[model samples]
Target: MADSVRSPRERYREQVRDEVKRHAWEQIASAGVTALSLNAIAKEMGMSGPALYRYFASRDELITALIRDAYRSLADTVRAAAEGGTTAVALAGVIRGWALQDPHRYLLIYGTPVPGYHAPEDITAISDELLAVLLVVCADPAAEDQKSPFDVLLGAKRGWVAKVLASPRTVHRALSFWTRVQGVLSLELAGHFAPMGIDPGLLLAEEVAEL
Candidate 1:
């Protein structure tokens, strides 16, 4: 990697870029991404408005970087867990802790999208990496195929999962795992469960335990 043999200028550029992203995250934490502003970031960083453009050309570009980073972090964490032989339930706990530690970062990836803001291909690819890790974690490689109603639907869309998991049932399980955890997590992080007397973690563990 070029970073392995970085020159001074390249290192400096990387530092400045990281600082810009840090400020962007702070802004996101204070307000939503809709409130993000390059000009405002420039003012905070003590750099001219135009100078900030050297690092990120546009607001969308910065959002892309942040999204990519968030997805990459989750992917890397999942991969590490898989390598460490973590169980699916434990992996779910890892994800829960990560999201709770930084709810804004969690929402940045899984939160509602801004209208008309289509993510770039690279972002989608990184997202698929996260899914791939989930597949590996959730795959019941030794289990026999079990056809459900959704199996037919998922088989029709086996364009990606078929390559990683040999069993259709396993693919369906992985899908269920992702959707179920995400459903519970989104609400928990959004404070939807605060009004309820029950613990959200118990609810989440129950869902994952069933998986």
Candidate 2:
């Protein structure tokens, strides 16, 4: 399983896949995910459309690969922060930093849903990892146990809520953290705040600290 023991053919396959993904990302950035075309990527890579299909059978497959990579990178980043004893505000900053580092990556997952493309279950599991980390840092025994109406509603309806083994209040806090942070990032990335000249980072800090 060591890198030194991998066969040349395996290495070549991985290299090709990586190269194809690079081209796909370029296409996603230039146009949009809905406009991503395997044939276009193939032409860019100097390969026939059929040849590219061998690497990624369809556009959805290529998209799934990219989404998986993006989610994995984020899950790892947040998990690392949680393990380092990050506070709620610090963790919000971590998420904001990751999103700012790559707006396209952030928007790809959170900006808008790709029509006719449903994320596979494994992708859901990776996202669950993100929520799990949020729950860890959002836990506060000293806080009041008061639950709002939405918290009760989320607990009753959201299947993942009970599985995470946290109270509805904790779940509510985590969800609020996610939504507020993402709201700031979405607006900032879309140039909504540029004219206002407000700092998104400070705005994000205030939002998380208030939680």
Candidate 3:
């Protein structure tokens, strides 16, 4: 009977933790980061004030966990997108799809700067992993072909060395694509397009075409 009671208690704890995180996400979506509060979230969950501290040390710790989860989710999305394609554009579209699905979540990582706010090292490391995936996808195959663009930039330079260093160009392309896509997404989420009567889908398509 004691073991059975222990299993149910653990399950209840997990359920409560998940409920709190869900409410926290809802609060974040409705208001900005400044609006997130453990007390409010607990109230929304029908729990007393002190109950949340058992799950999260503080609001900062909860925010940190959410950021980590966000990065991991993005990394997974990009990895799935890269599975069958070697094109940077393909990966860019995957990221765009993700942004469209949850602009609020996207902004949590890329929105307006917060003073004294620093992302945890693990989040940055996951971001690097995503960048590495983009790098691999953007590697130019034409570098080895006879009709390559290296001729314009590597004139009179060591061809082999230039080929080896072309990875930076791929990285630049990936970063540029991400930035452009994010701009459209952020503006759309903030209702910058509704007033102008512009269609964000068309803009997103144009950006993808430019890639």
Best by TM-score: 2
Q: State the weakest 10-residue window (summed lDDT) of model 2.
A: 139-148
Compute the lDDT of residue 129 as modeled in candidate 2. Answer: 96
Off by over 4 Å in 1: 1-4, 141-143, 161-165
Q: Which lDDT value does model 3 have at 37?
A: 91
Candidates' TM-scores? 0.92, 0.95, 0.77
Q: In model 2, how large is the Cα lDDT of residue 55?
A: 82
Q: Distance from true position, residue 182, model 2, in Å?
A: 0.8
lDDT of each: 0.84, 0.89, 0.74
lDDT of 1 at 47: 98
Q: For candidate 2, lDDT tens digit of each residue in 7-53?
A: 98888878899999998788889999999998888888899999988
Query: Which residue ranges in model 3 land beyond 4 Å of their true spot?
Result: 1-10, 143-166
Candidate 3's TM-score reads: 0.77
Worst 10 residues of 3 by lDDT: 143-152
